[model samples]
Target: MNLSNSLDKIKTFKKVGQVADNLGMETYVVGGFVRDILLKRPCKDLDFVCIGDGIKLAKAVADALEGKPQISIFKNFGTAMIKMDEWELEFVGARKESYQNHSRKPKVEAGTLAEDQERRDFTINALGIGLNANNFGELLDPYDGVKDLKRKIIRTPTDPDITFSDDPLRMMRAIRFAAQLKFDIEANTFDGIINNAHRMSIISGERTIVELNKIIMTDKPSYGFKLLFVSGLLKEFFPEMVALQGVDSVGDKSHKDNFYHTLQVLDNVASRSDSLWLRWAAIMHDIAKPPTKRFNQKVGWTFHGHEDKGARMVPGIFRRLKLPMDERMKYVQKLVKLHLRPIALVNDKVTDAAVRRLLFEAGDDVDDLMQLCRADVTSKNNNKVKRFLANFDKVELKLQEVEEKDQVRNFQPPVTGDEIMAIFGLKPSRVVGDLKEEIKEAILEGHIQNNKNEALELMYKLAAKKGIVNNPDK
Candidate 1:
């Protein structure tokens, strides 16, 4: 198939072809750029593979362009890059690679176009469009990548075992692509992933998390996660998640599989919000259920305090996964801790003080926390789900009302610690902290308005009760 018409539309492709022709080099726009073009997906990065010195081709192409864009060359990797007008073009020599069992890094050497294509992670990514004048825009598909694209399948270009064993990160990439493109992994290719799951230990946490985050960002992340679990890849890196899988029973009592429930929550959150950290919250909301599981004769099974435990577990998990240890991690942790709070409000009579407390604790993340709580209502009973959601709506309304009146979303006590110290002639001691806490609790409990006047009045009254007279030196 000829993509000459499509190639002609992209100015860079034409210029690159001309330059390659002039230099008597065989070059083709290969990998993801070619695949995305056929799929009509928006792609900003382009990879070009040539049979000879790719750096030289990139330099010549850069000189031929309108702005003569600066070329960034990597001498060790034998690749070069040029950035122009939202496009990132990377040039690499077509090469074959052989890996050692201990590492994913391959010994690289120049080879023909076929050799390079064979080394690609998947068939669709191996597709290439000719960038030499003689065969400009010609489609090269030795592995029938177009057919696989139509079939909606993820398959390696060569033997799946050899491919995955060479670079175990491809296992994650396979699952990620299937999730992103809504495709199925071919049986043999999937089997290969399962066979080489242990090899994932060789891959770094950073690389694995990149693929994991991509999967999480997909429209239905559960699909990728299920694949990861079934392929045994998850156990290699994240045994905590795998532990959430099974359901235990004492007589007729049993609990839902927290693993699948977490996935449902993840997908529900994905459908509502595109926030990656919020989705991470969903993934972690029930993460400690296994460790916290208990079976009581009265209640079937209870994962009491799982949310709190899960929150505590977040930092350690983030450290293990090489995820950011900043506010983002804290955000996820906070959500995990508070996920059950909104549901508790839904179950009980919604009160102003309850709503105010939620707003006060959740602060700026109250809305996101509400979204997570809504996603967590994954009851199999339709009526139960409806009832819970309707109650949630009422709870949200109450939250809005309380927040509007009290202005306590990110509430700071109207009475400051310094003020308490000055008033009571005390140092920065527990007494000052106690006064601040009391004032905050009064605001949240609706005993006093969240303003200086009421807080100051109550502070004085409480201080009088404690026999702490106000300083009169002034």
Candidate 2:
């Protein structure tokens, strides 16, 4: 089970051993680097734990490198970092951690390698690769982490309750790993996370979002989200998403589980693109459905105006999650607002005018919107899904054709409001606004070409309707 070849990848590991020997320290590459090495997964971040002064050992290794790598030292934390080719290598002294019941931050004391490993969240991550002069390139596995890795399992190195209660964020990290690696959480560990789910309140919103985003970026984000839901962790921070879980039945009518449907959409989008925001749009496309859901005798179920409502909720949700409130937030909001537009087009006539308005509203995000809509069509009936997909293909083709003809993917109205005001000999008023709307509608409706001359002529005709006279000279 020796990773003899894996050792060859770390050229500086031997140098680290020599340096640690010079400083009379015990050091090992620990945490994710060790875990990933065992899993044969590529990792660009390395964490080194030293039983003695890690900073001194770091400096010695820096001097031993061929070019004498620059060491960035953090005195307070007794940590140092060196950026190797394509890898960020970090050095920290072995320390035992004792956490207060109320805070995730632990009181740190310099300790042995065993103590450092004891504080780790998972057994696999607690594995270490020895870099001591006596045992360079040797792996030290106290928890049988290699066996757990082979089984594709995630289990805490220590007591699950104690480990997770100490730092509830690790609970999230555990689920994230399960999703990212497609590993099953060990029985006791999974139950502990569910039992101690309420303890996540101590974790900050920003930190929670970071772990959540990592889960979302995984191959099957729904795997992580389902774990989050089952563990009750999602309800602690993101109740809105959790609220989208069940179906409401009235009379003989029921709605599909929007929660699982949304996750399917997210997975579909993940398969197509790695754009984080686009996947986010998939997650949020029906966020308001629960609040807007209704059952009627006439209609089976209706989430009327849910798209617009979901869009409005984006900023508030982003704020609570401590996600970016800038353009990214706006992008997600725009997608949510328009998530149903493409479907509506698919359901009805694929008019050039309708597609043009969609293109104008979606702008650079038109393609992403279409993708979200395609994923949104999740039906248990295969034929129903196929029919919707066929219609969607038609809508996409129509959109493409319209875009090629009119160049209105993000097209602006050829006539500006200022031009409207000047031509009508009017101030910026309702009359002016009315004319502008008419001109834009005409362009979108395909009644006239999207050119300044045609718009101006139309504008004049509309001005006559408004009883405004254009100055002949001007």
Residue pairs with backbone overlap in model 2: none
Q: Give the TM-score of candidate 2.
A: 0.94
Compared with the true structure, all predictions reach lDDT values of: 0.93, 0.88
Best by TM-score: 1
Residue range with the least summed lDDT across 10 consecutive positions in model 2 = 1-10
Candidate 1 lDDT over 1-474, as tens digits, reads: 999998888899989988998888999999888899899999999999988999999999999999888889999999999999899999998999999999999999999999999899999999999988789889999999999999999999889999999999999999999999999999999999999999999999999999999999999999999999999999999899999998899999989988999999999999999999999999999999999998899988998999899999999999999999999999999999998898767655657888888898899999999999899999989999999889889789888887888899997898889888887788898878888899899989999888999999999998988889988863
How far is 398's C-alpha from truth in model 2 (Å)?
0.9
Candidate 1: residue 21 lDDT (0-100): 88
Clashing pairs in 1: none
Sum up the clashes in candidate 2: 0
Give the residue spans of candidate 1 off by over 4 A.
347-350, 422-425, 465-473
